[model samples]
Target: MDNSTLVKPFKSINRWHMLGWLLVAQVMVAFIGRSLAPLGVLIGQDLALTKAQIGMLPAALFLGQSIASIPAGFIVDRIGSKRLLLYLSFGLGGAFMLMAISSNYFFVLLMVAIGGVGYGTMHPTSNKGILHWFQQKRGTAMGIKQMGVTLGSALSALLLLPLAAAWGWRMALLAACALLMATGVLAYRFYRDPPSAEPHEPERKISWSYLKESIGAMFRHKPLVLLSIAAMGLSGSQLILNTYIVLFAYEQLGLSLLLAGMLLVISEVSGSFGRVAWGIISDTIFKGQRLIVLVYIAALSIGIALMVTQLPEGISFWAIASVVAVFGFCISGFNGIWMNAATELVPFKQAGIASGFTLMVGSWGVIIGPPLFGYIVDLSGDFNYGWFFLSFVLLFVIVLLLWAKRLANKETQHNKGV
Candidate 1:
């Protein structure tokens, strides 16, 4: 397709409308995938699971993402994001329904793992859609799309906790399944691929060659390799905080479950704002210098995490809440920026594959971090060590980002010389 044909459809449609639907799609998918975090306490109590086991729940969900992300990216690029989104909606609903019916811990893990397949597709598909729809203000667009994740998590914390508190976790999960089904119907009715994003021809024969080529292209890209490493570290720390903060508040800080849930809601709400704010900073204030913004956010996250570890005994609720909000803001802000950075590093056609590979590497952090955090808590009898561990992880991320920045500068100077 010519550039004019590619640009025409976006011109006809209100880009904001496209962004809005994309946000809604992200919210619904995230709600299904992220429900486990809020339900941790109830699931633990009901199933007689240890802290470590509860951690494994999110791990399993991420493990599924890790397994499916790269392949899903290729599929999304070839089949178009709209078709994959429809499939994702159904997959999310089915997984949640299975979770609702499960009576055993193993069965619950199995269900969540299945749900991870849906979670795995989210980043690549959403990023691809946003790149197609918004050429300018891409960072801001990415932030808006990413806000769906925090909003979905916030909504779950606000609604599901109460619902589960009254009706039980199973009922809450069933309700989630129903919502996902509704989202699926809406997506089927409205979602469309950008006119420019014509689906690639269907492969008559699937082969290792295609996979090898796609994966090799990503690995050979220097910025992508560095960014993936940074993503891994940042993602690990984010998961640690998201998965453990509520438990930490309730168990270590002597807060009620309702209050803990409220803290989670506050964190997510702050994160929602931070995502947009950081995007604007990257797009405008930083003049598209995404790596600098990413480094700043990661450093800020490490500072906040360290602060969490140092909270005094008998600290006030507002005091703890403030720290959590800052932590949430900084930690949640970078993903959209990094994703935008990754997309900028590659050709438009390769956006899906690059994002998928980057996210696949990052998913390992999600898979391992939560369980490790929980295990550290199990051993130490507190969240202090867990918070400290995350700080160190962020420190590692900063190092990788700085290295990537230097490499980027070298490339820029070399092109100038040429």
Candidate 2:
């Protein structure tokens, strides 16, 4: 067999080296996101944040994400993902450095908010890169790429938490800054706009007409629209699980910090493998069914509910950990499944924008999930309320899925009549 016959990476990563590069880039972004998470409690103490203000950290990121989505999508669609990533990687890294030096919490929060803009760019850039190049095996590639996020989340346990413990959370910010700068350099050299035989093609310059049409098309897209709504629901469920899992294990269940951390590590590690497993299943077993989105949603709903309803009393510590592992596997599966469905919505030309739109839509849950779950805990005086909240949230997702199925049926019938 001729080596020349092997697949080519679209642009800057034409060589076999690109696969390794893409994986590296995704891992870097995910690690940064996950590492910042544990700092929530510490930052709250330093900044004198209330429950509401602490909730604002994730909200700030998601809000900045909402603001950046169209612009980032436009940038990705027009200039390409590489330039955006370049700007973002450096911008976020610098923001981290500033975060290290700031005395006022308001100033520090502003810097973190600025970094959120950069954080917004990662998903679009990674999605565009892998999807364009590995079109046929999209799920496999995205699965591998998304596992970077899972691994990065796992790594934060070992890397960022220890560093924070040893040398203050502020110093940890500086270290993350260094990593972001390094990522920018490598991605600049190695990343490319997922090249097409068609990147810069002539189109009617951006007009109200084009804007109206795109929005109209996206809205008119029954499955895509429904999935967008579903994404928000399931992601909310995930937030409930993640936000309270540690406390649920430690404070609620009386596990030690070491044990809680170990459990999180296991969940994350299993999540990494889970992403890959789900991707393969989506590709081969599901045969690209639009319905798998709901299936995964349903499974996650049940798994999370099981841990909430059963584990506190009946199950041993190891069993609780096992339940968490199962929840991680079931819920995390949606990351790829959702993206894969979004890819099928538009032709390759508009895929970036379409994917970005749905992502921005789904990211709404990231903004909503924590606070909502937190509210329930406050109201009920228990994190178990958080789990019950997630179950109801999943119920909404099932509602959306049934709605999407009806639309899917309608579309099929209309085409048949024609």
Candidate 3:
């Protein structure tokens, strides 16, 4: 692949405008996924869900993402991101609306899982978009784009909680579904693929042999494999915070539902800012050393998580909020760096597949983390157990990151010697 193809500006479309819609798409999909953060209590009560069952709600959504992610990556690399985003966004929104009509927990779980199929498209499609659009400040651009996830989660709390309070959680989901589909339509109308330096073969063709080679190569890349393992820990920590923070504050701290939910908003809002800050740090201070930043994030996550487990019952609400804010900033703010690192390990043409493959592995954390945390909570009747569990997960990830950094350093030295 020609290196010059990586950064060519489009004449027909403004890259910044395209970035805005990509952010909108990211925010809306995340808005749907994190809806459970605020509405979990109401939904659990209405559906008579057990604690483990509540955790399964988000887990099921990520299950669908795990299932479809690799294939979605191939499709995005083949078909162009705009078309896939349009299709997946509309389909995902419709799947979410199905929950509005059903009161049965299993039925709603099925809908969320089905919607997860669409959620699978988000990272790959948006990643390829950013890769094609910006290169000089790619870290900062990716960070701004990745902020959609936290921003969406924060918005879900801000907008949906009030709507859920006024009407019902189902109504809140319906409103989210409507907005997501509308945004998809606008994205389709406006988003354009960036100009390619490889004019004859801008997009790769999909074939069984091609898929096999890409998959095999991805697994064989030691840095990618190690990073993928670290990604699982990051994903686990992130989902745990998104799934349980509100309830933890409510049940453990004896805060009101509305007030407990605001903790989620505060955490996600801080996470939203952290995404941008981490990106700038990577681009400037770290000079593209993303893995070191991730290592730092994991270490910070362990410290904050351990601290959470040790907090006393009578702690002030503001103090708890401050802790949640830092937790979110560390745990929720890692995707941009992780995704950028994964995509960078592969050819520019295969960036979508690399990201998809990485997320497929990471989605296991999404699938297992929440339910496991909830199960531990249920068994012990203590939210502290869940925090301890996340701390241990991140601790293991820090070890993996150290190993990856060693491998990267060796590879750099070998290249220099050559």
lDDT of 1 by residue, 1-418 (tens): 5767766765667778877878898998888788888889898889988888999998998888877777786787778777777888888789879887877889889988988988878878888888877769997898678778888888888888889999999898898888887887787678777766533545456478996898899899887789898898888777777777778888888888888888888888887778778988898989999888999998898888888888875678899999989988888667779888888777798897788788768778877888888888889887898888888888888888888888878887888899
lDDT of all the models against the reference? 0.83, 0.68, 0.85
Point out the higher-scoring one by TM-score: 2 or 3.
3
Candidate that would win on TM-score: 3
Once model 3 is optimally superposed onto the true structure by TM-score, how far is the C-alpha of residue 199 displaced, in angstroms?
A: 4.4
Q: Report the C-alpha lDDT of model 3 over 264-361, residue by residue, as the tens digit.
A: 99988888777768988999999999999999999998999998888786678899889989998888888889988888766688897788688778
Question: Which residue pairs come into collision in candidate 1?
Answer: none
> Which residue pairs clash in candidate 2?
none
Candidate 2: tens digits of C-alpha lDDT, residues 188-292? 887665445133455547788886788678877878888898889877666555545654676677775455656666777766666568777877877777555
Candidates sorted by TM-score, best first: 3, 1, 2
- The numbered model that scores best in lDDT is 3
Error of 3 at 198 (Å): 6.7
Which runs of model 1 end up more than 4 angstroms from their true locations?
Answer: 1-23, 70-86, 122-145, 189-214, 220-223, 283-287, 343-353
* TM-score to native of every candidate shown: 0.82, 0.81, 0.83
